[model samples]
Target: MVVLAGIQEGKDAIVEEGGIVALVEAIEDGSVKGKEFAVLTLLQLCVESVRNQGLLVSEGGIPPLVALSQTGSVRAKHKMITRN
Candidate 1:
């Protein structure tokens, strides 16, 4: 998912297939590495897409992302705020 989120086309496909929620779920319940990867993938998905950013917040992505930011590594916290 992280690799797929790297390209615009891939990000589009993932979003079309509802990847955002999956990524959020991963962050909520995944392993340490998985959460980090999910965060990175979400960052890629939201980087240049305001629509995705809105969808992310609408789909309940931020709380867990914020939670991850609090408990995750410094790099993960960095990734979370970088979206701003």
Candidate 2:
């Protein structure tokens, strides 16, 4: 709920947008399992954020995201890998 609210408020910004950070934090904190459906959704958003920010592949974020691509149902991996 709070994460959604943050996203709504910063609808323009990409990375600094509170919603993206909130969702990432939620996933890292392991609180989003009930919202497991959000994993793919958040990945899509993060890809967009990385693209818009022009983040390098060597950056810290790419590793975990790539690792994430190895798990989950095929559809989830599909979404994450397609962006790479």
Candidate 3:
């Protein structure tokens, strides 16, 4: 649950390759924090990470992040939608 712990810790700036991949895996595996608050917290971290680093478009992070952005369980899409 490092990813969940990470999000709760507010360390969104560390969405590096390994971290993002881990989060995505957790999300996909249904092992991460399933609570809406936890998921939304992770989502916010992701969005802010991309916005701060501008890596969403340049580093092929968009596709995966877009997929991550579409968990379909909340209203995060309204704030930052990714449709790749």
Find the candidate with the highest TM-score and give its number.
1
Instruction: List the candidates' TM-scores in order.
Output: 0.88, 0.41, 0.35
Q: 2 or 3, which is superior by TM-score? A: 2
Model 2 spans > 4 angstroms off: 1-10, 13-17, 26-60
lDDT of each: 0.88, 0.45, 0.44
What is the model-wide C-alpha lDDT for candidate 1? 0.88
User: Where does the lowest 10-residue lDDT sum fall in candidate 3?
Assistant: 31-40
Model 2 compared with the native: what TM-score? 0.41
Lowest lDDT 10-residue stretch of candidate 1: 75-84
Candidate No. with top lDDT: 1
TM-score, candidate 1, is 0.88
| Candidate 2 lDDT over residue span 1-84, tens digit each | 424323633434444444455444444444334224445545444444555234323234444445555654565466555632
- Order of candidate numbers by lDDT, starting with the best: 1, 2, 3
